[model samples]
Target: MNKSSVTVQPLRNTQTKIAIIGGGVAGSTIALRFAELGLDTTLIEKGPSLVNGPPICHLHAGGNLYREISDEQCLTLLQQSIETVKVYPQSVNVRPTVIALPKTDHGQPEDLLPRLEKLRKRYSELVSADISNKVLGEPEDYFRFYSRAEVDALVNKSIPSKATQASDWLISFANFTDLNKLKFPVLLVQEYGLSAFRFAAIASLAIERLPSCHLQTHSQVTAITADEDNLGWQVSTKLQGNDNIQQQQFDYVINACGFKSGEIDDMVSAKRQRMVEFKAAYVAHWPQCQGLWPEIVFYGERGTPQGMAQLTPYPDGYFQLHGMTQDITLFDQGLVASSLQSAQPKLAQRFIEKIDKKWPEQLIHNRTLGSIEHMAQFIPQFSSAIVAAKPLFGAQQIPGDDPELRAADVSFHGKHYARAEIVKASSALAAADAILANLSECGLITDPAIEGYLTEHYFPVSQQCSDIEVTERAILLAKQRDYPDALAKNL
Candidate 1:
């Protein structure tokens, strides 16, 4: 296929044209929202598909994983997660999460109560405001405490065939975990799992049906410059395996390129302060471990010998694992910041190689086995779990230097440009809404149709797919990406 420069001439009195850079969660969400509003939109993705950046298995509903973050951030996360679920209900894996503190940790379970209580109360209020906001289950069941004796009682019992209630999800955990190694009164919260691949499937399929939205995969944005009239932007893109460039003009440009947003910022001479961190999650197939399981979190100090360990379960006994230690999920110099001269942060080339090319088999084996060993400290049976496939990993961008920052939306540069710097996957929709609000303020959108869409009962344009269709497409996407088909389906 020969590539040639094709310019999109600015139309007179036409619908607002939007060019969204990157096809990750944030960009895809913004494009979908714009297309739903009947705006002429183009989604440019460097990869073959969408949402293929960092692996986001766990939805940080209530921000339970990060105890250091403020309660306000936790509440924001709760609200964002609710909105995300409403928009992509088919992408959610309906399961709870177990949060426990090991004996080696300094903090107690009581340290978590205040936040949990606040989350529960907020959840109750949201449900009261709109009954459908009860996506995390009944507010009363937002979180439940399990005393040591109660958990100990199930230590000798068999794992339930299927987990119906929150406690039922703990049978295997209680039986397999070394009870003495953990603190008392473990809490099970209503946080759930999100399949990135499934989300990509939904967004791509939905965009394909929208007449106003153009989906361009394998098209990388090479250069961006303001038009001579100063009314719009001229975006130059290069197709994969092609030397020629194609330039297009749009009324507005959104930088949503995940960790590479700063590159675009530099292209437009927009000053920014950002950090990028590379992280990975291992896939382990433990077929012998029968029965359904809730996602488990063992909190410890980050970047230490005893760091946070996460076990996320998928269908068919395939478990996704994350260890916050440097030897496992994190790496030395994995987190880097932008320099004074350039807006983009420089990660080590080895990480860039892994991101752009394939990971060496030896390195995959070492890190994955290391992740398995990290989990085996609490659950001994997990030691028998072998590496299932290549890890799900990518570099994520933190808008500011604060690594602990969890809740963020979109930031605007000028009247016609916006940058989405969401820290969590749940925050994608909120960022898109912020962009829409900015567009309205800039007079690009005179009349907004989906105001307060999150709280209302109306369906999103992307909700055209039935549950079964979403499942089938998601599973096919997983297989195409070289992941196990089970990862796309819920347990």
Candidate 2:
């Protein structure tokens, strides 16, 4: 039996059913896709709204997606994301981002020109020559590098450092007055600030109002099992504050739950997965300091606990700072997991001090976002980030080279699809596209009309989808380096 010609199951009825578990960006997109296709779709989320708290990185926007994937891929993801939030355009805002490369003994600051030249070259291909914006510039203009003078000028023009003694644009050490902290600054883009919050609210609104879609909140999925009779899946969900469980059977199920995906997979499969935890902090500036800067990334000296601190200013007038994480090669699953809350305050204070020591005025009068658990970053192995599925058969792990099956992780196991670590919402667009393409490849839906629509509207992927294996920074690899009280590791 040649696998290429393998005959699987197809939709017996014209009305195909799909259940999108988790209402974050990806799940929401999947729901929208099925709805647009006129399929019977249901969106299940434990949270009251799509923009639920904590687990995922709801703030970074798609710029980080740029850092992980190719420029073209990133652009497509963002475009899809923009389209998803189209119902509430105000919910999506794309702004310029700046990454400050603080002076270090290692690299030449002058080298930034060539490196940025290349990055911008890649960005150039994405620009629409005719559709340029005065504020956004050409699409390529969105990606640029500003020297010290340029940075200082922009800072002064936008949000001047109120200090009696002025400093460079980049946030730095306590000795900000020390001119030595300056280096090259690079800009990117993101779905950040208030845009991230709006992305969630509007996505929920757009999905809920769809006539073919049923948006169910306060509902938690407890179990997902294979339906032997329907050759589909039975999803069991329980509403919050209630013990009784309700179930629904669907032809397909998509798991875009971020950190909790493996939990849902466990309901039907025996496999379990691991997650990498990253600690972060969210600080809101006083409403008065309206320094609406785009996503700002600051790189610290090697071995310092501040190896990486990305500063994001919200449309609501707050700042979010995400710091580094501790490396755990040895699994201490044996040790009782420390209370994540007890460690959050320590992480928050550490980030607060990092910001204060560098830019005191911002946090001069501010508040913490919410729980510390919100600060922890838990990512499952990248290998399983996105998996295409069949109801009981599982992911179609086709061997050798096959571009069609290779597009995204089109894993299929009993009509169950899952994408892990969907931290950035933009990735959701690609996930939905992948599922549609893979579903067709699995011989599940052979309608030429639906296929034609998908082909005409597919998210172009120049390269196969794979987990980003590169750790953004290696300076934090120093094992024994001591972190200050504020930057110390939480329990």
Candidate 3:
């Protein structure tokens, strides 16, 4: 990626300014881009900091994008997010997640290598670099299929009979039984894990660190009205800490306030109802133990695939295990805390029992939600459990629904702008592009003399928040060769 050689003048109408509501990944990245372009940007977050804590707020990124979107889009956005997150004040652990696939028929362990090799042949550009004995793949290189032996080596533990019985490391079905097989490939993927506080901390830092940007934390937006006088909108903000009220104007406004987007848009648009579904999960921490746990996403061994269980480990020896409930959700920020605490341990505990029985019980020291939990009886480190709510997929909404997100890869332009589908962190990358397009379209950021300057130099990598593994793994497959350019494919 190239950096611009020329200086940029302030992009927006100097007096009106640009008010960005929300400080999550979507809003923060948008703020980062406008600021870099030399725009006078004001970012407002209702919370004390960008990422407020867990009455809600513990979040995860990676794999979801890699698996759901195209390889080009996934890799590019992931790279950008990785870079931006490096500056997060807290620790961001880089870990490769392993997804298990269960076998239905008896297949040799040798069969796993061929499958990955075939993927390698098909997507030569996606392969990771090798490290002497093991074949590496993307995140940095090609995602690989690890054998059971390799899995054992990764965990530094001997293969248990339950593990050894499976020819491979995958468990495809949602539910496993004595009949289901385990002799297939386990997907080894590169992913990142960090506290939402850390994620938000870095994002807030990016907004404030930019010379042209002003970050207003704990600033609640009370109203937005048309200011045809200035050909923009008048914004009313109540400074929570000072109890002071201030009115400002912006040439353009972007609503990236997550679930509350519609609630905020009510000042100008129609009213829309918001909803969120509940999900149960458990977490625990072990003392005096070195955590080498690989994040594992399990499918199932039962009939058709059941939902998966995602296990993430932190630097603080706090290991979180959740999943089982899948699909999207819509949440109300105010209810997140009480709801999670009120959740029963049924789902999370059932997931633990359904997956494995070998976990040693009695390692319980702290339980986050309840006194007696089923997971504690099997896993020594099993602590407390709770349920969480998330914004449902395709849930971002505004009253008028002017700037739509039918397809979220880009932005839609209207009186007020928004990246409507950016409910997750990864969506921020592409949504940033959409926001820039809107800014440029609204004439708030006009720099035609160096027209392609920003897009050419920074767009490719702006979304990254942390350092990334840099390598140009070339495309080698026949089908892949036909496309010729790997950059053309994006989701």
Candidate 4:
């Protein structure tokens, strides 16, 4: 048949019925895609409806999304992400910002240059690719670069005080620049404000599109039961503020409950051998705080560590300062309050001392107000075949009419402390290259040239325990009915 003459007919009975357990970005996005494709979909959220807000980098930062995918795939993802932001303006936030690394004020130390060279090479390689470079290039068509001296000059002009120590270096910068070369620091200026609610709303929109989608809010799913004679599963839940119990059955179940996946797995009697929960802390402050670097500055005793502090301007004359520390128990209130209490005094004292020794006129104390903390548990995704073998069975019943099951062995905050290694800039770039190489090797794409370019341009630095083989095995076990920990190849 001729292309124009061929009539496209919609499937009469090919609709898919889907149920999403969480309403976060991933779940909501899945829901939307399925719904758009005319599937029956429902999304359940444990918390209140998501508040629409500006897209925070924390929600979609590098380690969260970019690390696993190839450059071409990443670009496509980034574009889709940007488009998603536009579609759900209320549910997403996007700040047109660029990251910069400034020099330490203590001195042009020996170890600093090598780090810069590594960063420079990686930065160049990213821009060298036509697709990736489009995201990095300025309107003037020149690549952006910063020297230690230039960063210092900008700092002096902005702060202009003797109290700031040279050791207090401003190494990284995330600025908003036009297609033209004109650029300004995010803290010094305001660009976009996205509501957190908006992101959640858009996610809801996406989830609603799935076939047979059901979203239960404030309903705690306590158990999962697999059908003995069919390919289906049942979920048991206790409704919030009600004595009544509820149950749901579906052909398939996707547990996107994040760090809480282990508990959900236990409810279904799914055997999960190795699930690790890593804790992260975030802090935000207002603009009145003095001695605050204009650009996002990364601090390392040996010099500046790659990807440390992320300083971004928030709505209502406030700025968010994010640092990923080793502590996992610290969440919203505790994390924010502690960061302000600890950071304010030390930063103020340092800035004041530097001012007393250097330029006196610019000395000021900048204290952050209204601090907030967030704790997230990341669980890796596994194939469906793996999950079917270890179908998370619903909670076990006790003989004495008690419906409670013991909690899972894993505590949200009690997992082993994963060490954070400060990688050299070159090393960070090299890791990205390695990820690209792996993607190429898997035959996921046709391009082999990108891997070679990534190798030549980026250098590898220190490695951290972001992903452990045990975690992957746990994911596989949780997914399947037959492949328990005993079936794991690595184990």
Assess every candidate by TM-score.
0.95, 0.62, 0.60, 0.46
Top-lDDT structure, candidate number = 1
lDDT (Cα, 0-100) at 391 in candidate 3: 12
**Candidate 2 TM-score, C-alpha based:** 0.62
Candidate 1: regions farther than 4 A off: 1-14, 448-459
Winner on TM-score between 1 and 2 is 1
In order of TM-score, best first, we have: 1, 2, 3, 4
- Candidate 4 — which residues are off by over 4 angstroms? 1-12, 50-56, 59-143, 152-195, 205-212, 273-307, 326-491
Q: Kindly provide the TM-score of model 1 when superposed on the true structure, using C-alpha atoms.
A: 0.95
lDDT of 2 by residue, 1-491 (tens): 12223222232335667788887656776776666555578989887666442323233323342233354444444444443333323443434455555465244445444434553444354343323212233445444455556545443344433322222323322112223454644444333333333344445444544566788999999888887764688899999999999989887778766445555656666243333222224443334334333455554432243344444444334444444322110111211111223211122343334322332433322212221121211111111211111000001111112211111322344444544334345455556767877666655566766567564432211111111111111112111121111111110
Clashes (candidate 2): 21
Candidate 2 vs candidate 3, TM-score winner: 2
lDDT of 4 at 410: 13
* RMSD, every candidate, angstroms: 4.1, 14.9, 13.1, 19.8
Mark the regions of model 3 whose C-alpha exceeds 4 Å error after superposition: 1-16, 53-92, 101-141, 149-183, 241-244, 270-283, 288-291, 300-306, 326-413, 456-491
Residue 125, model 4: Cα distance from true site in angstroms: 12
Model 4 Cα shift for residue 285 (angstroms): 4.8
233-295, model 4: which lDDT tens digit per residue? 677777767767778766445554533444554555443323221222122333333332332
What value does the lDDT take at residue 462 in candidate 1? 78
lDDT scores of the candidates, listed in order: 0.87, 0.43, 0.44, 0.32
Worst 10 residues of 4 by lDDT: 375-384
